[model samples]
Target: MMTVIGGVDADRLLKDRHRAMWALGDYPALAAEVIAGLGPALVDAVGVHPGEHVLDVAAGSGNAAVPAALAGGRVVAADLTPALLEAGRRVAADRGVAVDWQEADAEALPFADGAFDVVMSCVGVMFAPHHATAAAELVRVARPGGRVGLLSWTPGGFIGQMFATMKPYAPPPPPGAQPPPLWGDEDHVRGLLGDAVTDVRVERRTLTVDAFATPEAFRDYFASHYGPTIAVRGAVSGEPERAAALDADLVDLARRADRGPVGGPTVLDWEYLLVTARVAGGSTA
Candidate 1:
């Protein structure tokens, strides 16, 4: 199960790490609270119709999948982390919606080609180690004339800036790896889709998270539940001062970025890229 990309065997060396990172905390809980409303928004944007075969790739906790199912599409929720897929199953069950949950890698989906009428990912897929491979897989599994929708963090957005804040302390990405934020770029997204699709459209949107009372609270929550923050904390655990400094810097970032009134609940605005495209005819595998 070795997927070679950029001269590196990512399946052997990176996929496990990616899975472990996401498995660290209850991402479902965090995602439910922080990304509330985004799922439905994406579903609506994609115009998921009843009886359509929908696949939500890298579908963390069934966010988009549940909504798609609710909209009457036959949904399949797929992710690399089993725990996340399980969480998605629970969500589907609770909502009285049926979704086929699959533990599958975004870079290499387990489904057949041209299997779905609509393929969607919300704040997912971009994290895949091999961006090009992941993108191709997305296009590959979608039927010709089908639609693909994705929501990704823009490089200049707040969340992207937060990652930048932690970059100095965190190890650099794998050699030759494309940064996830590139998915946010309209031009880059066009390049990734290439001639596989048409009627490609990219729109910028903002999502607001109002879970914490202050910037410090926001920082604490992320440090505890967000995978990247948790990893960064562990990476600097042996160096107490470094960890503290990193925490302080993150708090400052939250404070400066907060758009809410001072002393009010922290309402952070995150800008993202929303992409929608129709798979071109004759591109089906």
Candidate 2:
């Protein structure tokens, strides 16, 4: 039986499942090692200044939030998964940076309008079920002239292809559900934020992840640590042959994209889009 919460659309129940999926594996452990460097880079790109109020939506393990706090901004790290939030708290504490952590939903942020000087999400908000609602919330929470920054995987990127590879094994998304990779498209982003902000800019960048000696080893690590991969693993668990075929396909894809064997370790280059925009009526500087 399907259940709806807070008068949300039936399809929106996927949010609950999404939450569960992320909670399965140790995302913080994996994210800390995988995308840690991108956090500070994104914070810098957003121009977070000292004394400004910064909100890191879907802040996994305080990656961007801790860096913002270190940059002298008052930071609030929010996410739907409590485990990830707890992990973020630990990270902030360990880094000796003060960050206010909150459990939050991106689509309908638990924040007042014009509440923050800067809002950001790094590979985070794109996962929200309702893209438009999430984009609006990101804009709505920013003060006029405030900046908003985001990073998302482009449809043509390695990560996007990886997602496509898992489609055969994973359950299909709800009908009409927007693809998360669409957030990486400049035109799609313009459509989403056009009315809310100005000076919108999008840039393509590459993020590299450490890979194991062989594609099979890399696939095993992702299958064990990554949320989506884990979900797919479970979905095909009962069917051994199907699971093997899916694994084989993913390994082949990895081999095709490999950019390693460079002495020490191999790496996979994942292309992502960086978006920066200013709330309408704000200083264009």
Candidate 3:
């Protein structure tokens, strides 16, 4: 049974908020220009084959879905934000590929049990508030012996640190909401999928981001284009001093982590965790 507040399902309300938050950003641009390689990388790792039924959960703008379809698989890209789904549809259309784009919540996917040959999320699903529920959904929708792949930002990565930097100024998370970075922890994920999967493989990889020219560029871009950062900035927008402090801190973080030449482009190696495993035969619940 779902908890209800003011006649609305609490979880549904949260999902609605999440949908709006993601819709706030120019994520399609971010995915295409910066993190575009992630989807293909995860698809390659999962060995998505021709004619396979592939599902990309929390798939923002067809990151993995587009590539999976191009690999000759029938793909479905599911996300909470309709805007992102529309954007993904456009991308697929432009690529001359077909993908079934649907609005779906990662924690409660609208799919049958054992419905897909490949279930994956590239830097997606990790943002679902309830980690355990989302993990179970991932396993549940995969056919027995089907592959499950996930790519998430590590707790110690540049993106993780950015989240940490923003935490001080952000609003409190709802009850039962877990930190997104925990999905990057091997032990945490293993426990979440325990006994339901086998032949698990984990890899730590880095994505080199050089899109921003300087620390301020990184800060401003995030403020305008990243949903979470935009939300944080909005939260502090009314408080000018705190907002300025956040701006300064974000710039400082980028400056400290920048690996490029003393005065050239900003080079940041964002680390992430990649996990793939075969679903063990039997009922997934």
Best by TM-score: 3
C-alpha lDDT (0 to 100) for residue 139 of candidate 1: 95
Encode model 2's per-residue lDDT on 76-137: one tens digit a residue: 99998888898898999899999999998898789999999999999899888778889999
Question: In model 1, where is the ten-residue run with the lowest total lDDT?
Answer: 1-10
Compute the lDDT for candidate 2. 0.87
Cα error of candidate 3 at position 72, Å = 0.9
Q: Any residue pairs clashing in model 3, and if so which? A: none
Superposed model 2: Cα runs more than 4 Å off: 1-12, 262-264, 283-285
Q: Give the TM-score of candidate 1.
A: 0.94
Candidate 3's residue-wise lDDT over 131-171, tens digit each?
Answer: 99999999999999899999999999999899999999999
Reference-based lDDT, each prediction? 0.88, 0.87, 0.93
Measured with C-alpha atoms, the lDDT of residue 204 in candidate 2 is 95
Per-candidate TM vs. native?
0.94, 0.93, 0.97
